[model samples]
Target: MASGTEIPAETVAGRKGALSTVISIDAMGGDRGPAAVVAGLVLSAAELPDARFILHGDQAVLSPLLARAPTLAGRVDLRHAERVVTMEDKPSQVMRHGQGTSMFSTIDAVKNGEAPVAVSCGNTGALMAVAMLRLRKLPGVNRPAIACYWPSRNPSGLNVMLDVGADIKAEAADLLQFAAMGTSYARNSLGLARPRVGLLNVGTEEHKGRAELHQAYAQMSAAASAGEFDFVGFVEGSDIPSDRVDVIVTDGFTGNVALKTGEGTAKLISGFLREALGSTLLARLGALLAMGALKRLQARADPRRANGGVFLGLNGTVIKSHGSADATGIAAAVRLAHQLARADLANRIAARVASTGLAGQDAAATGAEAGTAE
Candidate 1:
């Protein structure tokens, strides 16, 4: 219903409370479908006493899982939608004729105010397309970006990265907006007075890539000078986890690769250590003594903290977990959404967009009003 057809407002509505908002989940959207989603829901209920869920999917397919995970069924309500959009479903098809699908309905719940956020693990492209089409943008936002949280080496806090496969090709202005948007997120959610923002570039130089880098460099520098954020210049992939920067901005394609590579490396390292320790008696004894340390490291290495991606720059809060997310992973995403909604992330972003003159008009508009203070 949100369209660029209308002019951007000078001010957007304030954020609602997390406890005041409900989470709508598509139980049949992931690799394991309702079973895994149900397990996650049950865990979520225990962790979040105030936040509830509205499961949108085929009740017939979910009934058995519902019985198995009685706690979730008892706590959360259900809304049936006879159809589901699978991982393999064509995005174009979903974009073309997926009106009655459960994923759409789940999102519709948020649009209708029945839920504050929507979480799903199915058809990334379809979800992004649908959300963009339905929720629209926050005035100045060109294309909605996806953000994922990375657990820093320092456990005290986490780092955030955005455009993780949302927009493969990004404009310089878009990246700058993304950085500003990201900074606002860190400040609002992590309680930072001035969040450090970094552009994902090959090097820390002012001029890096061919045209794209040069263009983005100018915009980012200007935003920083304008006091939009504590812009920390360019950061390489290696710098993402060093905790040197609070927000790392990149295009979706590169961000997605980096995300997947990080996960793959973690798994590889864990497996390698397991095999190496089992190969010798001394190593086995060492492993026994260091089991707790190993487990802790493994947990730290996990990308799940960064696994659940947030669709930033949208009108409403929508968190998207990995398409192959497990029960615990999904639970974590729900919890993060709870925190974000409670943190008033949407309202904060809206305010930033309004104050900084970001959300001036939906790009789709041919003649949206312009030239305002915010």
Candidate 2:
């Protein structure tokens, strides 16, 4: 038997119906191990008293952790998973021999409908492979994408960017699908009705970029009105942090490079500020005077606050937390998964894909008719 704080009065009723509120977690996949995962769960449990967790890991390791987190006892259901997928393991290797592993079990829970969403801080490639194989893609979705929240100058303080690393290649039609999927995600998750969509390109000029991008630009421009999104035409890399667009669509190769570059730049800026603030006695004193403002700035720019990279266009929602994430980052990922699950994000993506498919079919039919008339 496990130990933890009893479920609160308010959450008791909801706990009875755990299917919707439960989140499947891979407790042994992170770099920090089960301790950080459990600590994160404790933090999340404090905030979301009604949310339940289906933890997958070795019972010997997780049992003690749960015993320490009394507040999370009754809310957690542990499933013993003997194996773990390591960071060094290739996706192909894991796919063939990853059965009974925590990551696989965590995703299986969501696929089996035991939980609505799954959160894991594991190998990205392996996780993606397992997810695609198990959860599969939604109807009309050719290639699934990994979408992440980018801190930006938008009113909501964040913008949605997709195809971060799911697939390195995307055609003109795939880009349009990304835009439509991103629009739905913004609407459901960010509460934006008709999000402004922008395609990342070399420049905002009409003739810029590769031939595929140019073709994609024309398609996106023509479909903007019908897609219920405002296409701001082509946008440069700088527009990712700008408030001009709520969704930035790009192929995975470009998006991944941009994502890593942005993360590194943010870290460099933060380090410079710290160094400047502590270089001299007077500088330290000045920092003390501005401590409160600095705290606010740190809070606003904290990457941990936006820890989850959502895998969109799948039949189920899967949140990939950073492998090196600590307790706070894990909690943030759990919080995001809970939010997306509550909003029925999977169903929303399905509807968006279906709509886009119909639109493509209509356009093709129209072109065929025109050819016949000519």
The most accurate candidate by TM-score is 2
RMSD to truth, every model: 7.5, 9.0
Instruction: Kindly list the per-residue Cα lDDT of model 2 for residues 241-295, writing each as its tens digit.
Output: 8999999999999999999999999999999999999999999999999999999
Worst 10 residues of 2 by lDDT: 1-10
Error of 1 at 26 (Å): 0.8
Tell me the TM-score of each prediction against the true structure. Answer: 0.86, 0.90
Model 1: lowest-lDDT 10 consecutive positions: 364-373
TM-score of 2: 0.90
Which lDDT tens digits does candidate 1 get at residues 61-175? 8887888776665456788998889888877788788887888888887777666678988888888888877777877678678888777754445888888888787888788
- By lDDT, the best candidate is 2
